[model samples]
Target: MSVPILKQGEILIASIQSALSDRELVELRDELADRVGRLRSRGVVIDVTALDVLDSFATRTIRGIAYTAKLRGAKTVVVGIQPEVAFAMVQLGLSLDGIATALDLEEGMLLLQRWPK
Candidate 1:
């Protein structure tokens, strides 16, 4: 997996590419956590449009990613969940409660733009 960061002022969109598998998710959790730690946080948008699935491990990783980003002083928003991936993620019993989610990148960017730096 690859995490490509796109910066626009106080916004940082981390576009994740490739499948988010169990082992890969672990690596991402650590790597993304470190990346978040190093950033002068603003807001984070995880663009998972390129990913094909969202299993339990992947869901956990995302939650980890969000928490880690928050620790770095950034609000994390997950975006671009495909229909199938959404269904899978929901089936994993992951709650969106306090977490933010967007159907597409455009909406994600808009929301991220509104977040406080």
Candidate 2:
């Protein structure tokens, strides 16, 4: 399913409501990249609370989104990563190194707000 990206002031928020296929995940990465530039956003928050699993591809894609947005002059924070997902990622040797993350959307927004532009 296509994820809905909402623009909130100078930040863009993409809340994933369901599990997405690989292609859809890539589409999200691309779309967020484009929107960051087009909208001149200062930050981005991607909420993946609904996702129960994050395979290598999904993990990589999220990291890519953060990096790409950073290069485009916007900070990115991933939020809503469940406890199970975090454990699974560690077990699978997956990491979101150098990427910012928060426990939920509200915290994600606060992080972005606190960071220097």
Candidate 3:
């Protein structure tokens, strides 16, 4: 299934509600980039609260999406990461190097709101 991308003010929120295959993840990345450009979004928030597992490919795809959005002049914040997923990502050395993160969607929105345009 395609992930739902919602627009709130100048921010685009993508809530990942299921496990995505590599192909789906790639599609999401492209869709997000296109939307960011077309909508002239100031920020993007990717919510992964429903996901229980995150593989290396998924992690990298998210990072790629963040970078791509940044190139299009939008900041990206990843929120709602489960503890297990966080541990696994760190264990795998798949650090979200340059990406910003928040504890929840509310904080994520706040972060984007305060982010420099």
| Best model per TM-score | 2
Comparing 1 and 3 on lDDT, the stronger one: 3
| Model 2, span 1-117: residue lDDT tens | 399999999999999999999999999999999999999999999999999999899999999999999999999999999999999999999999999999999999999999986
108 Cα displacement, candidate 1 (Å): 0.9
Which ranking of candidates, highest lDDT first? 2, 3, 1
Per-residue lDDT of model 3, residues 48-108, tens digit only: 9999988888898999999999999999999999999999988988888889999999999
TM-score, each model? 0.82, 0.98, 0.96
Candidate number with greatest lDDT: 2
Tell me the deviation in Å of residue 34 in model 3.
Answer: 0.4
Pairs clashing within candidate 1: none
Which residues of candidate 1, in runs, are more than 4 Å off? none
lDDT of candidate 1 over 3-109, digit per residue (tens): 66777766677788876557766676676666666666577788889988777667777888788777777788889888987887678786555779998888987
Superposed by TM-score, candidate 2 places the C-alpha of residue 81 at a distance from the truth, in angstroms, of 0.5
Per-model C-alpha lDDT, please?
0.76, 0.96, 0.93
Residue 93, model 1, lDDT: 83
